[model samples]
Target: MTTQRPETERQAPVRVFWAPGCSSCLRTKEFLKKRGIAFVSVNVKDDTGAREQLLALGARSVPIVARGERFVYAQSNADIVGFLGLEETAAEMLPPAVLVERLDRVLHAAARYLKQVPEAELDVVFNDFFAPRALAQHAFRVAEAFVEATETGEDYTYERMMRGTHDVGPGDDILGYGASVIAALDAWWQHCPDRSCSAPLRAYWGVQSRHELLERAAWHSAQHTRQLQSIVEHFGGLPDGPLGERELAGLPLPDSVWMEASADA
Candidate 1:
């Protein structure tokens, strides 16, 4: 249930709670910006009081859009539109099978990139969350979490997806994890009898069809894949077989590789 706001709160500006390296956060922020919607972009990682504010609204996650004590989880665009009273516009997505194929390619590329990250820089953090090993792990695990959720018949919680960031271990381990995730992805795709992915799945953010979740997983991984490539280039080396337009086509990827990841945000 949504908390009722004071009558005077109708004129309040929107507040977007987010963290760096969060794909959904980027999407939510961009969604508001594209419409020229004035919002207070709050970086939860940097804001000491953000968690308390979020908890007051019955949320304990990033990517939340709040007006006073009332808030909505900012994962589903449709929900965000409804929360903010914006016009609805459905964006087209690729076929479910094609999304699977593209996601597989993306996870493979992530593994390759992880192998190339310098050992010294693996632990070094950038953008608070862009430690090369972490980003590489995230790129693969984003989709792996989806497959795991599908098999386990469980809610795909953000906490579940974000479990192992602190202990990413060595570069070899990162690659190993990536390989295992890709394998799981392949196994799930091959054995999944329902290619249409129309079955509903519960997520911490909202309930949606498996196909919708898969699309989110694919695009999220693609964004991090691009980030991983940027990390490789940051160290002044070329990425081996970095993803191109052909590989990324039809996925709803953001235009900027690092979109507004500012301390000011």
Candidate 2:
């Protein structure tokens, strides 16, 4: 006779059979947190029934995510990404072929901005243009929304980003910029090989022109650059030039320019 896995055990990580205070469990928790996926962590030692569940699932190890009859041992970022269907979204949202192409234009523009701004004036410019923490939070929120919408078969709307409702001050410029960058990232993800499931997202973006999207991304980056400058000015000069290489490397650019480049191909 087959042993039945309890209802709670059937839930998810699907069943995070872990030992309490285990280092692996902690790492697994961190990974899930980073991806924004909610999971119930069951400590095998505390929950006696969970051990039976693990045994039935054929997992001798402490850290395992059981899904019904099948189970995945330990926490593998790739496994989690696969189990959660992250690749489909990556393919649909950001095709591997077009990745570098989209990134290049944005980086070039950032490089140019770095050259134009003086070291002493960087801080003031950045603060006046954008708030770093706020922007980072917004990006995180957007990413969470995308992940949720993708998983639940729902459409993630950015009406605030598009309509400029989130703009804090000065003619809704910052909100507009934020919306544009989100749009660009959405576009890149749509074309990616792993994110093909983001077709709905791609279709949603299709309504807007590449030029319009890129303009918003560029504007957003420019504002962010200005904000960085403000930081430098206030702090009495930055140690590393103006913007770090990593920051410049990740700037969002126009898709039209991306499409024309050989790098994406």
Candidate 3:
């Protein structure tokens, strides 16, 4: 059955397809509620037709949200922040430049790591996480999108590559792979004149307001650095040393503060 928004709800139109007991779905609901944006929530399992409609949207995950014609599947904190244009509010929560920078560092490190290890060992690493064909495809997609997005200033086509695939082995390894992808993007960005460090950097902040973009960008970048460390541990095993505590301390503000601010708001 199709669900229509009430007259009041139509004033701030959003439609959220959710499944009960999904944490992401609840988070999406709460995020919208907090922003005072009116939304129509459809429990996909309760309605057969709604489930089909969701499938038609190319969404296979819970907490799929649509605002007018723009839709994002598999709601994430970043996705929600970007969609709602809450960069100003969430700016303190993330370091914007961190994503690109961390991406740069990790990709280079992985490449170096691969060089140090033998082909057989690399094969073992690939085998541990992904099929041979799948690993090659993923690497190629990451490299290609980094080039395309940098050259054209378009959205990275990485999302398209990830479609139809759900189990990315372990979450940690997937994140490490993501770091590698970001690294490729950074390299491409550095070479492309059309791509300013500032533009894609803004994505990390999720800010609609231009005035505070840079500050937010830096914070967003720093946050991703921490996340990348976690991803490394998931894939390559924990670091033998202290794992760069000084780097974290040097960041403008701790993630704790930004998280609290987002939560409080």
The top-ranked prediction according to lDDT is 1
State how far residue 27 of model 3 sits from its true place (Å). 8.6
User: Alpha carbon lDDT of residue 262, candidate 2?
Assistant: 15
User: Across residues 3-25, which tens digit of lDDT does each residue of candidate 3 receive?
Assistant: 45445533456788876433346
> Sorted on lDDT, highest at the top, how do the candidates line up?
1, 3, 2
By TM-score, highest first, what's the ranking? 1, 3, 2
lDDT of each: 0.82, 0.42, 0.45
Which residue pairs overlap in candidate 1's backbone?
A: none
Residue-level error in angstroms, candidate 1, position 40: 1.3
Give the number of the best model, judged by TM-score: 1
Query: What C-alpha lDDT, on a 0 to 100 scale, does residue 22 get in candidate 1?
Result: 77
Q: What does the lDDT read for residue 259 in candidate 3?
A: 20
lDDT of 2 by residue, 1-265 (tens): 1145566644634556666433335445555555676666676766658788878877666556556566665433344455544543321223322333433333343334433445343222232223333332233233334434444445434443323223433322333444454554566556545432324432132332232233233334433344434444555555244444433333332112111111110
Per-residue error (Å), model 3, residue 148:
2.4
